[model samples]
Target: MEFNEIIERIVKSTNLSAEVLNSKINDKIAELDNLVSKEGAAHIIANELGVNLIDSDASQDFVNIKNLVGGLRNVIVLGKVTDTFPVTTFEKDGKKKQVGSLSLNDGTGFARVVFWDDSINIFKNIKENDIIKVINAYVKENKFGKLELHVSYRTKVRVNPDDIDPKSINATDKQSKAEFVDIVEIKPDSFVKCFGAIVQVYKKNIFFNVCPQCGKSIKSDEGLSMCSEHGKVSPSRKMFVTFVLDDGTGTIRCTSFGRDAEVIMGMPTIEAIKLADSHEDSTFPVDSIKSKILGKEVFIYGRTSLNTFTNSIEIITSRIVENIDYNVELKRIAEEVEFGDKN
Candidate 1:
């Protein structure tokens, strides 16, 4: 339970004013040598007052995104869907399984909700901007140390529940807005936009194989392309580019995939593929296009994630904007200044 909710419960059960409850919570904090957070102190106070803050039935209460921790089971959460991804299929133990994911924001923070197997059917009905209530979910930390809410067949989902006030979800569309910031100010697990010049481009190992049907990476199996979901199939070539971007504040490594990679290369996938075929060198396409993108200025909007191997934050580009207009940029700056002055 959140601190404010706990305090509300204590006030109702023990007939204590909110101010008095806060005072006692503060005293508890000081008594513990300021080692405990206000919410922890509030929990202790609720315990001493014989007030049960946690609901006897866990599914009835919603847990705030900020309070989520790993290993939590039978958890309930309510949030606005910020993003959804395509469902992917895989084979495990001679059985096929599907997985899908979406991002949720509850005004406290954002979390990724993963659906497995039959649970993906629930995800198929979900869309961006919808308010959802998830019951009987479990929490686990991803390899990157980010908390994720996993939904299985036993979990229940309510889409835009009638009891929830849409107005109460302050972060309904907040995560969709990408704040433009300097590369130096970028943090992990955040959506951001930046304007920078491509300082360096890595030209080798630019192409990868993907299953044409589902667009997932495919592997070479005995001289045949094999997709875990599609079995043996012809694979299509996909492109990705990694480069260092500098905006005078700092430099960050940014990666662009597929169409965005083609944009950066100033060439289409077919043309690049033919170029590589002609030379019989898979690295030839990047070698041909590297000079054209060096020192090119562009705007990138994407999510930042920690690259654990590098111990640094990197951007996985969602969209890349090139050929910027100086006049439009000046007008935007003027409007921002005017709005700031009015506020």
Candidate 2:
């Protein structure tokens, strides 16, 4: 789990305000002297969350916040709900599934608790600054190589009895965190990261006429055109390019338009359309545009959607990074985590 994941999980699980919680966490960390102490102390707002560490005489094991690691199963922990991320819904096998998580902290350290599917409802009721105990939760690393808890149907989430009402923490800090994700995991999420190589480019209908006002495909009436949705209108040319991206495991057909398509074509949409229109009767500059992208590498920050007509996933490219080495970027991230080390 990343720091934002930790911060988000806490903000959502308790009634505490995110703005206040962020401020309090940052202020606590700023007071610490060294990296290790700063990291550990940053988690537990002792008076704010009212969490305590306990041990039983039995042989059963319980992990601490700072000791959390990836790939741990049947793990249990007791912590205060610190913060939470916004709830997100995604489709899996044609059915919708919801996911949410909360940041949990004992005095020793901090961790993220993720809720999935039906389990997400329980976490939904949990508010910030609530004292909660989770049993039978599992741990895993996210795209950024940090530990987070993944709770399942078998996991137990409960609110501990307390006499006092929950209070909001000072969540005023605005530290930012971002990470790149695999292309396979791309879906209708935020501006997520994806990298792949262009396997093929489909150039037919790369540029076409659309209604200037509403952007719907137009019906040609000699010089003037008619839009089915908007009636009569002037026509404007737009780029709509389709291509294939291969990421070793699979291939996905990607469709991009306007500015993103122009990035691959190396020219403006109007210019390409004019060059094609110069021909006797050309729909688009098929051969010229295709020549620009076949077999090239690309990194796209785009939006993914499931096409109901095809019932398959497709991408709408927003930003493109042509032929950049991703391995080098990952190495740089690792170096920053190990040395500078601010969570």
Candidate 3:
């Protein structure tokens, strides 16, 4: 058990705020001339308060970010917030729902923490570089097969705990370089940058509805477009492109969203929308662009995930680097060769 967990247990038993308990623990530490550790002081305080700090079934402990896996429950973790995303709202079953997320790093690895509905209130108080302790949170694999920590009603989050030194928490940089890998080496839950040629394109269902205000997908409610954040409103169209990329070693399906899709199609989304309107065929935009895209070489930076229905891995492209740079490619190849030789 960690010192934070001990303090939490004492707080629960004594109905005391963590601040008050921390003050007592600090005084205890000072009274002993700094001879005892924070955990030792916490134990002494708990004993004086007549709080039972032991539990036979106490399995929850601080888990490192890298070791977290899907389907984990009652998890505890402490990490520094690296990035925070705005809260997004959507409608589900005619009710409004809000979700917010932040990226956390604990030096070992990085993970995303998702706050749902009421939990967004807690997320709102968090800021970048804040060291937060999360207790009773759950871990689940997202659609991309990446593990995410989800905060529920039972979860307790302490932001910048007094006993912890901010300097001691060294978080990994979120903008670290992505691994460069070939299509054959792509693995689920990994981000990679690869160079490939467009070999095939799926032209059907190239456009979808989105909320103009938030750019999130909007649903039809009783034949009316509804955005959870903005309520009923006019929706905008967003385009996505799906195609197969082959890098000579292997071929993998890839999907690019919005602006990235526009890059792949060689035209703006409005032009495609206009073309679709003129032809009265939604698939015509992609149909017209397919000939231009085939055999085009480009660099793809994206995340790989399993396509459950197809039982194969696919890439959700984050970026497409066009107009190939042969010099950089040669250097990357040389590095790969050197790495292989070292192995």
Q: What is the C-alpha lDDT of each candidate?
A: 0.81, 0.64, 0.81
What TM-score would you give candidate 1 relative to the actual structure? Answer: 0.45
* Residue-level lDDT tens digits of model 2 in 121-240: 887898766777677876765433345776766688877635322332222211111235566665553454455778887747676788989888898877678998888887788887
Please give, for residues 1-343, the per-residue lDDT of candidate 3 as tens digits. Answer: 6998898889889989999989998999999999999999999999999998876433235788889987777788888997665566766567887777777887878777877768889999999889998888878653334567778777899999886788877776624356768789889988877877999999797999999999999999999999989999899999999999999999999999987788788888899999999999999998898888998877777888999999999999886645323344335335544644685
Shift of residue 10 alpha carbon in model 2, Å: 53
Measured over all alpha carbons after superposition, the RMSD of each candidate to the real structure, in angstroms, is 21.3, 17.7, 19.6
Worst 10-residue lDDT window for candidate 1 reads 324-333
Q: Show model 1 residue runs off by greater than 4 Å.
A: 1-176, 325-343
- Comparison by lDDT, 1 against 2, better one: 1
